[model samples]
Target: MKALFISLCLSLLMILSSCEGRTGYLDEGQQNTVAMLTDVEWLVVYVDYSISNEQTFDDETNIYSFGRDTKGWTATGSLKDPSIKKDVRYFQWTFTTENYAVIYMAGNSTDGYWMIEKLTPDELWVVITASDPVLYPNQYKTYYKLKARKRQ
Candidate 1:
């Protein structure tokens, strides 16, 4: 009876040890991505419109902020556009994939999806794509590549 009790206790201990508690609702990769995104204020450094072939290399004052709330994340930024002017825009953001490779933003001024091409502690590159035939007549799909870096 003593040997059996010891064996049972050891088995229980092994099982409990194998079951590790989750750090958060998000997986490790997603948590890392979120941490990287929220850790810095991103400043747009480059922009490229695929259809128009327009590339802007000039220093941009646009700053992007990603809130860290796992339940209701937000993406806010100020865009300096001649047509739109410099207005602070707000959008709810979320990762569409389990790998956290894509980000979707929806708001009045910005409504699109961005595929994260590269993400690092200091730099981020995303390919923005949107498709709205009714809103954007004659345009089937549009692609915009944006590169941003952490503000110094």
Candidate 2:
């Protein structure tokens, strides 16, 4: 029994040591991307997916705002759905190599994982692969394109 316990401990130690840690700084290009994304509040100009249709944000009627901070982000807007209430939430964002993910920071249940497709000062594009609860059994590879809101 003692020998078996020792073997188990050794095995656990090996497994733990093999796991990678999330400790790294963004490269120069990645830093630039992050800077641009955080520079201004973004309007959701287009969202195309199996779960949701494409939408354009106008000054009146339809409006969506998404922004990122140093450590977290916030988004608040309406989906133009009568049945669904307006969405407003805060989340923590982490950026990796050409990818980023958001985790709900306020106990809200929305999370997102996206791969960066195009990143520019004026335009930001990302691809999201997910499965919707409403459209279960069907996966969606969605594309979201957003343009920076004009600063007045």
Candidate 3:
């Protein structure tokens, strides 16, 4: 009887300890860390996210500003020129290193969001998703992005 009781206790302890070791955890703090576009990287106009059906805009420019101490970042992307858009000047995207961001567009009908898909010292992929289409009100927008390595 003594041997049986001792064996039972040992087995229970092993089982509990093994279970504890198998649990998994997720840390949101390190999910999609990306470089701020305003401060670190220069904005290159390769793809435009603001071209709606009814708008006619012109040559645009953008600048970035990081939060006081990496708490977040803000982007002011503007639309100038009267050919592509009208009554539109600029938009702002506010973000954090947490990998998520929000862009408040300048035009009357433009607004959206974004996030970092991946980031590295050499290469990066920032995915941007937006809503409020000129023609398709029900459909949202999405942009998968890649950033080249900065020159030394």
Candidate 4:
């Protein structure tokens, strides 16, 4: 019984320590990256979510922004642009990793997996992957390239 107890304790310690090892890469750059992402509400300028379709916005009027706070991120505007009836006005967002995030939309509908292909204070690039309910055995994948809107 004592031997079994010691083995369990060692196993527990190993598991906890391994988890801590994952955070060693949180340097200044990572903080800056997150800060840049959360700081501004980006405007979508170009998109190529489909294999054949490419979409662009002529002006910032039909645009959206991502504003993140203590709770999480809030994505508003132009959600309908990418696809029909998207009309996503407000939703909660959370990052799964440095390069990936997930969005929780209204009615328990998840927008899908959001991947950050590129990020900068001036430019933000993202790709979202979701399933298509309308099309059986198909998925919805889109890429968006955005730029930070000039502050008025």
Q: By lDDT, who's the top model here?
A: 1
In order of appearance, the predictions have TM-scores of 0.61, 0.54, 0.33, 0.57
Where does the lowest 10-residue lDDT sum fall in candidate 2?
98-107
Cα lDDT for residue 59, candidate 1: 40
Q: How are the candidates ranked when ordered by TM-score, highest leading?
A: 1, 4, 2, 3
lDDT of 1 by residue, 49-74 (tens): 65566554454445666778522222
User: What lDDT would candidate 4 get against the real structure?
Assistant: 0.58
Please list the Cα RMSD from the true structure of every candidate, rounded to 1 decimal place.
7.0, 9.2, 9.6, 7.4
Candidate 1's displacement at residue 134, Å, is 21
Clash pairs detected, candidate 2: none
**Backbone clash pairs in model 4 (N, Cα, C under 3 Å; residues 3+ apart or in different chains), count:** 2
- Count clashing pairs, candidate 1: 0
Candidate 4 residue pairs in clash (backbone atoms < 3 Å): 49-142, 49-143
Q: Which numbered prediction scores highest in TM-score against the true structure?
A: 1
lDDT of 4 by residue, 1-152 (tens): 99999999999999988785646455676667767876765667788858798988774323444555423323334433432223445545655555333332222344555567688898877766764222322566688888775432
* Candidates 1 and 4, the one with greater TM-score: 1
Model 4 scores worst on lDDT over the 10 consecutive residues at: 99-108
